[model samples]
Target: MSELNVVSISAAKLPAGPFIARHLIDGDWRQSADGASFERVSPSHGSVVTLAARGGLRDVDAALFAARQAFDKGRWSRTSGKERATYLLKIADLIDRERDRIALMETLESGKPISQAKAEIEGAADLWRYAASLARTMHGESHNSLGEDILGLVLKEPAGVVAIITPWNFPFLIVSQKLPFALAAGCTAVVKPSEMTPATTVILGELLVEAGIPAGVVNIVLGYGDPVGAAMTADKRVEMVTFTGSTAVGKAIVKAASGTLKKVSLELGGKNPQVIFPDADMTSAVDAVVFGVYFNAGECCNSSSRIIVHEDIAEEFVARTVDLSRKVPFGDPLDPSTQVGAIITPEHQAKIHTHVRNAANSGASVRLGGGPLDVPGLNGQFYQPTVVCDVRSDMPIARDEVFGPVLSVLTFRTLEEAVDLVNGTDYGLSAGVWSENVHTCLEFARRARAGTVWTNTWMDGFAELPFGGMRESGQGRELGRYGLEEFLEAKTVTMRIGRTRTPWVA
Candidate 1:
């Protein structure tokens, strides 16, 4: 086994106390109706990070009412594209200006590396900028060729009162992905970020108000999924629901929304894979495998947790991957050099460990560290960089979304077998193939079941490209033109040029 990559523990000064986070309703910051609040302990520093509002059904009702009013009044929904673009641009500038403050809170609240949080904030700004451009470029279709006397038109209009429920992981970035697109399409929203990571989203609400978004245009409610998310999804006033979280929760949201039959968009979990051919660049493939599994502590929905390597080179590749995984910096998130941070919570940490333990007990080889690590100065949960090889295709760890820094290795002899291994799980979020031959790469790309396929890379994302998954991974896309369309409904307008239609009653 290689030495654990225990980098310097962060000695950064702790905050004076928990940051007070409140709900944003109708352009005003307010507390919960019941005066209930929750405390979030930093998963890295083991200190109280945020004291956030605990919204209930009543809060959800108020937010929904505000969003419904905003949409119906049409102050924002009926605004011209250029006008909407102006608001988004202002928000983007504010995001850039407040990146450090948001990043610091996100790191403390979400247990992500501060550097990564900062980058996500930067990327989120770019997403807003992209959505701004989309706002300006939005258009409708005109069909003058229908007839000389008659013309048909297809107009795109907003799907009002969107309910956005984002998960704890990537809280700020994921909300940025959904909210800006909805706003660009002239939709009002009620947002419920995960209770664990609500501070950054609240900070975003401040930015939104500072950018001069109208009252009730984007109301935010912070609390648990039961009363908060549930109420948001089931409310009759909400026309659409866009969520990013666990597959089980996503299914429940779908069932809840079925009562109203509102439009639903989900970006759920993944056990993504990276297939490595023998002829691929060994160094690059190995590096990517390490980065993919360990990035964001493998809490991400798109984490490349599994790797399918050709039998001819499986041994060498797995060895290289294990070695590289050992070098990934794992320690305090405040330390800029740490690449992997603490697990979000002790419960999640236990879940990650259970998966690895069950796999090892079921005859898999634990190549590297397979349990929790002890950080010198932190009292929070820290998982070791683990690599599991000799994994059977049917093993739980091989197929389940282990959602930790645990890498599973599966071997395949042929391209067919590789593709099968990649598609074996219920997830089809993202997959990658490493190959030197163009033909091999193209064929694998064609055969992969995932929504996003990378030829020689993994998890390289852009605001211009559409992203989501198939099967149990998710439904609907999150970025680009499709993202804007997710919040829009098409209306057909047919007019007779001279009112020359025959009267059917006559």
Candidate 2:
């Protein structure tokens, strides 16, 4: 990884002109109704990135009204699935064309490595293409049973205007997970991206317009959760709400949407566990664990922050993990070689340090990093990759979601104990098992309560696979056919050809 300590001033240049960050409503860019705006600072150096319009109730109302009108009156909702697919394909092409620009914007805003940011951009494009394929192939069911006397048809129809709120960690990718499928299902939407990383999402608005999406089919509103996001949840015009963020906020959304009973899909926080058995390949397990926790600085919802190792291999695994964790390069996000970049914000960095301090006080050994790095020429939020050992499952550090580059290690002697440790947390988002024994790996995969389990690997995902959580981690799934179903409401139609009246009806 590149060891460059400072953001490349030359490479990190922003788009020219007085960029007026505004809300995209009804195919036009407009300032927030309240005339409020916020400065987006680069996480790598705490410098001003751009001024983004701070949306509120008025902006939310306008976006939602446009989405509702587009769904209820525009041709987008009535267009054939093939026609929708064509637009989505064009959008995918546009994303690929603008990959570098979007990736740079994402890196500057979120402080993730440029390499990872580019991968996310490519992944987002693939998702749009995948969703496009699903759009054309989406089909309803027809039942011709009942001796030809009755015809039953099951149809999948759009759920109307949807509200999508995405987090900052994987800004474009997370939104791609929900938005493309919603569009493929013939639904109009209003997207509220995280305030920290709203630039890329805003650019997406321009891309949609270029791709020929209808005037009001897709809208972008920038702001925080309150007043803007809350307005979207409470608005009766929005039929469905899909969010990717914290469990606390997800709960609040669920409560707010209860009044209208909107279809809600949430991908929330996780305290995921990675299990390493004695028989597992030490080299592979160590590398996978490192990538699992430290990738994106562990801001990912499915980050395997907890490492549960077999007692026999605990010492070696933790040692190797610590050594590898220490080697993770921390520097400029724009540097192509940097493996670890700055934290999203100073507050988040402080929270990570606090978690490490508490863990140390609670008797967990700090095996690797426990504080922030002071790289020259870089005055931003950078936290060292941390590894905590000798942690009990009951410890707060082991149970809570740190959302940083902090890994907590626990040891178990038996398979049953390992399974219990993995499933002990309230989160059931994702988990990983490393073992050479097929039965052992399969057993752990079966017993683990997570929605997605990795055997002999970690943090692997595909556009075609369904991704989400069970229990408190959140409801519903994203990607694949299941994702399309999330934005569709099923309708059943039955026709009686025999002209016979049912007794109950009479």
Candidate 3:
């Protein structure tokens, strides 16, 4: 085994017992109606990290009813821009104050590095602040040129109650992406964090309460998808459902919401690619490849798991990536120095390994780490930073989302071929090009079938730029003015001044 493949597990403090968590419904902390609950085991430490209320149909019903009542009462939805902005800003400040506490719980539940968890928590606060800015600046439109004495008004109104279903990988950040924007748009919401990682979101609910948000504006229910998420999607009281998870589950949510014809916004899976040209900055490109694939243990939907490189430079680039992959620390998440932490579950770790084993069997070369890494003093699941070369376009590892610390290397001879390869997957979440040539970068950016295209960059995001996917990746955008618009409904009003409207009766 390469020395860089595994890192020595250092001693770290563990929580004495699982933290007790509860649901936030109608601005009150509550337990499951049946007193049922579930435990979330730390993927890095193999110990129970959280014991949370397992919501049932009754809990989901109550939460949805609360959200609908809140929206109908117009406590939040009818508030002025300034009033809403005030609440959002206060929530942002609370998030900053509780950052460390939230980050620690998030790191425990999500199995990501402590450093990454802290950064995500801090980044989530920025998202809330940005949403506050949007709340204050949201507006409608007026058309005075419609006709003489006739005024046309375009009004933006809240979309009523929304169901926000977030995944385990990015509990805090994803909720911040959806909820604050929904709130900024004056919409009430019922949020469902994944059962595996529900602690931080519950913490966010605590912050919302501390920020003095009105009751029923935001509610949270914790449990599995069957009861909690299904109830949220199928509830007629909810006007919209915004979800971030796998494409398969996204399809299910869409189908369920279709019964009520509820508006839906989904941020689903990705097999994102980063294409490199021989004329590109090789050093920068190699480093990005390593960072992109290994970041968050490749569990992120935007992970650049595959790279289509120029045939001429493929050999050297793959070798450099392999070398860097070995150097990334992999061990317990609590160890702040560990760059890549444990897998979310043993099954997921096994699935990641299956993908690699199958790819190797199909003739792809496992150039470096390709199996599980045993971390000392940690009994949790962890996969090695893996690199596979000789990847064919038709291979499963090249097309499917093997979300792990694994990189698949594909080679191309022409820009057209590179673009084709980038667009080959069923996912169109994100794609990138690394080249010094402006023409190549511009052409690729235009031709790539992705929601966000990064030229000479990978996974750099902002609150200003809208993010989502095209095709099966997802529908509807998130983050930006567009994100707020997703939770709004537009209405047109026509008024006649001075009784200048003509009567049609003859």
Candidate 4:
């Protein structure tokens, strides 16, 4: 047996060490009232890296109470957009300053390659900066509908205290995606990060405090979704709930927030499709499909898991894709040369393995890498870049969100069939189309059900563009001005001027 690579981490610096990191209720890290703690599993090696306190309903109450106090005080909300933008912009700068440390920690905790982690880290910092820039341009509507003297002015205000629940995949990036915008909109928030990956969020809480995000303005509570998430979602004091996770959980969020009719935004799971046509540059198409599906170890929700190739080019594309899939190097997340890292955990690894096995048993032909990988000198949670052909659209592996390095290739006889197959799912988060034809490009881009449609590209995202889904994929939106609006509510200030004008009513 060979020795597995081990990395040590501590909380003294920017990169966090394993600890009983607790809730930031009223801007302080305090242990949970119940004293319950959960193991912080490092997906890189499928081991407990550290212990973190699990929050109960009481912690939720405390966090929400602090948020309410901050919101009611109207300090953040009353601040001009220009002033709020400064704080957000400062946070952006701090993220860049500590980018390397945060990226390293992210790679270790999330089992993502160093390169990918760095890219995500950079992207998140850009989001804060982007949100800051967007905040300045926010304007109100001035309509003189009633009369010239009676101007019907409409203003956008912060949605009060917000409950932001993020997923485990891109913890810091997703949190940055929401928080800067919420702060830009002048809202205080209680952030509940996924228990599996709470380190980055905890580290970010410290950074937020340093950036002068006032106490109660930004808080993090680590816990399971049930009591912590349930309490926040159902609380009447919370004006908005922004969540990113599975569709099943998004439904629960909707149900929980229904009582208070709070504003909500969800960015959920995806089985996004990539349609490859005969006209596409086969070399680029093959490379894009391989990277699209296997990048980040196939953990991204925006990943194009379904490769819908035209019958004319299906075999060739699959052959080239299979050839390239084998080239993706999988190993330690810290290795700079490594391309793919481990699957998130043992349970997720087994889930992916089971889906692959089920698909193979059900008659789908497995072409390349279909099982867990054993890298030399590394006992990490790794999986080979899998490619499956002869897959029917109805197969479980084809329809479900395995969230691992598994790709399914299906043939489409026509453009209509390609579109149909791409949209034939409960998800509509994103899709990709590769073709040289202008008409075909425009057609699919227009009709694809996903919130994001990329032509001749895959998984290229920016903060200026909205990322979300249709159907059960999610509700509301994120990024861009639409994302900023998600944290705001519009109120029409209608005043009665020249009352004598409506003498008949009097």
Candidate 5:
């Protein structure tokens, strides 16, 4: 194993050794049972950042056992809603208090710009606080119209142990989306964060402990997806499994979880579209399109990688978009001014390049960048923001989720054609429509098959609104009151107030 190289962020108030990361199991930190470990390399410089313990099947078993024990023993499950809310609030408070440290860690591990990292950290804190408020407000419905002699009562109960498996793109943000809601719903969880970026999630485990979460209420397992993640899905004790990653892996998780028939929720990949009508504001559309596809280096699941523009304005719009794409600053993730950062891994970077090359080979015009980038003092994986024009809707680049800073431009002649182009892919996670006419916006919003449709904007999300997708983008929703309901089961209870026996019972 290589020695861990420490990176100091003097202005961000980080700890001495920001590289060392560990797993949190049953409210304590420990090494894997087999003593296996992996090197977590920094994406900014391709250097060994830390040595994270590589958990396997045994660790997954321990985590599942812990979560099952906590749920069945009613340690946290029996707590009052207000008590749970209080703990969640404390966790939110701790997140805010240590925002700087956590944000620095996230930037180092994920290679997202420091500014974006800070925003994500604060957003996660807000999500926890929002979930805490929901904990107190969660209530069951009462049906009073049954009859005077009969009564019906509906109750909402937690769904036993939940397995939360998050991706690497947004470590803290994505985990916060599910973990707090599960805790608020009175469900114990075993979290398996992506091995590539596990530091912030592990740090979150520490805060959960400080906030007085009962032992085994929330366990963090660190390792690859094969044994650790697969074990979690196959375990019968885990009643629910929620995952956020590629659609391919999501399908495998669903199949494995079928053995025990676990309730599963997936937030999968996307090849989302941004439709720019000719009547739209060109400046605003171009700016929003750039930010939509390039934010977080286009690693977001809902990134608008496909831009369907009206043929009338395609030429000008493509030119402006290409110009802006070339100007997007790509450098150190720690730099606040850097708009784009290094790719998560070399393999992923290679995949991005291959996609771009194939697009070119398929006769799509490379309007801007079409290859990797090299920055002084940085030997990490980095790809330039690319904009491809004259792309056919049937091309692989236009249909697949590149998960990189590459945008494919396609032209449409009419509203029906635009909607068809947007819905042509297997994904329906998110879509954006830019039009000044309210009728056009409303029409497109209604016709688009996506779960979330934005008008004149892109990638706008709120804690109070439900977010999810249709078709291959995945099932179930995240955030808002709906997110809390995902971890709960509804039960109906009927009582006889008068004569109990039915006529047929005699």
Candidate 6:
């Protein structure tokens, strides 16, 4: 690890500039090899905050080269897991030290509310710590089978160079969920943070260097998704691709890797279901459903796009969820008092707007909000908290990932109907089953098609919990022991100890 100094800068102390380069690589800040750049527009004020380097295929190659070299020749993968763990710990310490800047930058770039960004940053630092702990735990198994002398031993080896592609939604927080685990598995990585939200990812690279990670072990390439993203996806050198984005793009990455047969892990777009049974706590169900959709302005893939309530409690749940959602304000991301902020970019805002507009045209009732609002202090890309009830599973708004503050409410009577409605969507990313009844929870949890099932809570859990999906929500998993395994490959070693009679069956 390099001895770069990151001890002095605080979240509150990040220096403002004609922002140099947002891409971090080769242990320093740098521009795209092509010398092109893009302006980062603040969705809050509709003004340019900075012009960051516009990277291309050249940058992708450079980043991949650095990561590949680090993995193959720099001894990063050869370092003892215990020894490498110290570097992860040091990086965690640095992340904690610079928590404020990290969080603030995330908000400033991603246009999420300040409080949420702060929480995400703090969570990121904790994520690093958690992943560090898991480093020692990314262990393979030794079992006594096929006779003790067979000596069945499985070794989990790092999957060489990793390409981590993150989205604009959660920025560093999402990357945080992937990176520490990748590092824990001893894989060198080339990170492709979204072109729109690349600031903190670059800053994070600085902290990693200061924490003593060797140069090239972690590299960042910033640019458009096509050339840069396609480069990483198609590059035969990248052994594994850990991506978090739209299901459309995730599928592309998976398909692209077919040539190299590269390993792929994805947390793709979701139309998650939140099923509320008749026996559920009505108040808790309403609150969970409301928060699930509005938190992060419904940008979350796991947001409760489909709210399935027993017909018995449907009316009351809808009323309470609407009341609570009204309390959420859409405003400036910088305001600590703000609960919701602008969508990530104008394009995304337009996408959400189109969904709402089309939903109304298709006969869905706009229960609360389904349009853009002009705030006194903020305007640009801010979208109002929206609720759409009387929705059919076939409606585009009900099935597609709008990725904004929009909720689709549907009613179900029997448990069978609830299960069918929840599983109706093509996506199976995550689902929530709300019931005080253990049998209901257990049965729903067992049968839910999504990757995760939450009881009485939404987006509440530990890093040790595994997160991923069953079908088109993308392949593989993230977090927990499963997350560590994505960056690892298990090898079986067998030695002859007692007999050398391979020709005869014993």
RMSD of each: 1.0, 2.2, 0.9, 3.3, 4.0, 6.3
In terms of lDDT, the poorest run of 10 residues in model 2 is 1-10
Scored by CA lDDT, what does every candidate get? 0.92, 0.89, 0.92, 0.84, 0.89, 0.82
Q: How many pairs collide in each candidate, listed in order?
A: 0, 1, 0, 0, 0, 5
TM-scores of the candidates in the order shown? 0.99, 0.96, 0.99, 0.95, 0.96, 0.93
Candidate 2 stretches greater than 4 Å from native: 1-19, 498-506
Give the per-residue lDDT of model 2 (tens digit) for 1-506. 13223333224554553235689999999899989999888888677876999998889999998999999995688899999999999999999999998998888889999899999999999999999999999989999975568889999999999999999999999999999999999999999999999989998998999988989999999999988899999889999999999999999999999999999999999999988888999999999999889899898898889999989978888888887776777778877878888899989999989989998998889877788876667767888788898787788899899999899999999999999998898999998998899999888899999999999998888988999999889999999789999999999998888767668855
Lowest lDDT 10-residue stretch of candidate 5: 1-10
Clashing pairs in 4: none
Q: List the residue pairs that clash in candidate 3.
A: none
* Residue range 468-491, candidate 4, lDDT tens digits: 999989989899999999988899
Winner on TM-score between 1 and 2 is: 1
Give per-residue CA lDDT, model 1, range 1-506, as digits (tens): 23877866767777888899999999999999999999999999889999999998888888888988889999799999999999999999999999999999999988899999999999999999999999999998999998899899999999888999999989989999999999999999999999999999999999999989999999999999988899899889999999999999999999999999999999999999999998999999999999999999999998999999989998888888887887888989999888999899999999999999899999999999899988887888889999999899999998889889999999998998888889888999999999999999999899899889998998899999999999999999999899999999999999899978889998
Number of clashes in model 5? Answer: 0
Among all windows of 10 consecutive residues in model 1, the one with the lowest summed lDDT is 1-10
| Cand. 5 TM to true fold | 0.96
lDDT of 3 by residue, 131-166 (tens): 999999999999999778989999999999999999
Q: Which window of ten consecutive residues has the lowest lDDT sum in model 3?
A: 1-10
Off by over 4 Å in 6: 1-18, 498-506
Report the lDDT of model 3 for residue 24.
94
Model 1: per-residue Cα lDDT at residue 71: 90
Residue 331 in model 1: lDDT = 89
